[model samples]
Target: MLELRLAQGNLLKKVLEPIKDLVNDANFDCTPTCLSLQGHTPMAFVVLSLRAEGFEHYKCDRNISMGMNLTYMAKMLKCADNDDIITIKADDDESDKVHFVFENPNQSKISDLEMNLMDIDSERLGIPEGEHHATVRMPSAEFSRICKDLSSIGDTVEISVTEEGLKFSTTGEFASANIICKHNTKVEKAEEATIIEMNKAVSLPFALRYMNSFIKATPLSNTVTISLSSEFPLMVQYDIAEMGYIRFYLASKIEEAEYEQ
Candidate 1:
């Protein structure tokens, strides 16, 4: 039996929050070193992949595949006791190694396990497969502010990018909002290109909802990455900690009469 006590609760929250929004019963195929979890939502599904070079006291390269129940993982992490020994059911087929047991109490921990994982559902995980016309990463806080600003004036937010800069605008039956990118607020980087290509504007409501979760993790960075295209999904990535990041993808929702007529 492998036994361990870890304290990195926030890390668990970061990993589960975005995934909960995508899948209901997530299967964590975990070994001692790597983890890969993926599920499908109606609109899109996200695959979380992670790796650790060395784990626990004894350094032994052991390959073990364990299918953990989400509900069990949820309850264990939700009301985690200080001495909770996370037990894993081993494969009867493989030989046991003394190094398979991981013991380290100095891990991480967090409060809201539910909040850590975003809205878990089937509908929100769908993503249309196609070649994206454009992609760019931006400051998540800046993008979140832009969404809130444009949302105050109207129900819809229109995002556009050009040679000049990126712009957020919204206009409905009566009100409207228009905001432009500034010199340092949002821009093109020397090492990386700024303002991902977009031939048209996407519906902002869903995009905002998706982004809200992206920045929920602690220790916010100075910037967030935003990638978009006319016919493909929009992707936002937040680098929260070392080797810990959250990537959110949202499909474009455009009314047929907007620009196709």
Candidate 2:
């Protein structure tokens, strides 16, 4: 048996909203220590890890993988109030359905939902731990705004990180725009500051549509971390307070010259 209770039920709702469009179904791997989901679309891959300690109550008799349709799960979660307490349960041996229970703070309302598990076959990708060429930490809202603004100018945004700062640029048929964020550790709040760590300068173009989708997780964290390397996929991560983190990995677009070669 596996059970987990979360006081802030809205966290699950916020987590699902960003990735439901990108992935149709996913496996939620439950263990004694954590509940994690890993899925990928053609353009992006995502991982959500929620630690057990963050939950109000967490119990696991055995490890289990519960496959679920994210769209349906999101809808069910929508039925819950933002302040409700959410309890999820599944029997490790005989359970074909995962159960969700929601209770309001005043105990005036309670709701329960049962969703059937799926037999989905997915291979988990092993994420390497190598250092990236550059890493930029900035406010989540700032990143979202940059992606939204750049999308209006072009289909793709070129991201460049240097000692000076981080740059987002795009060129449309009629106009071009550049937005640069200079490194600054001094701020009123640490989360509001933009910090950059660069071992080497890196620049690459990525699909703005996907980047915009990734930023849908902006509400989950006050700040977002972006790691970039010329040879690897760009990683955008949002830490969920004391719980865990949601990370989105997007491959850089190949330039016409590189594709031709």
Which one wins on lDDT? 2
TM-score of 1: 0.59
TM value for model 2: 0.96
lDDT of 1: 0.49
Superposed Cα deviation of residue 164, candidate 2 (Å): 2.5
Error of 1 at 207 (Å): 4.6
TM-score per model over all chains: 0.59, 0.96
lDDT of 2 by residue, 1-261 (tens): 888999999999989988896899999999899999999976589999999999999998778999999999998998998999999988766578999999999989889889999999998888756889999999999999999988988998999998768999999999999999999989999999999999999999998988988999999999999999987789999999899999999888873335446
Cα-based lDDT at residue 136, candidate 1: 51
lDDT of 1 by residue, 88-183 (tens): 233334333211112235535433221122222332233466755444555555666777666566655566666555667777677777787633
For model 1 the local lDDT of residue 101 reads: 19
lDDT of all predictions, in order shown?
0.49, 0.91
By summed lDDT, the worst window of 10 consecutive residues in model 1 runs over: 95-104
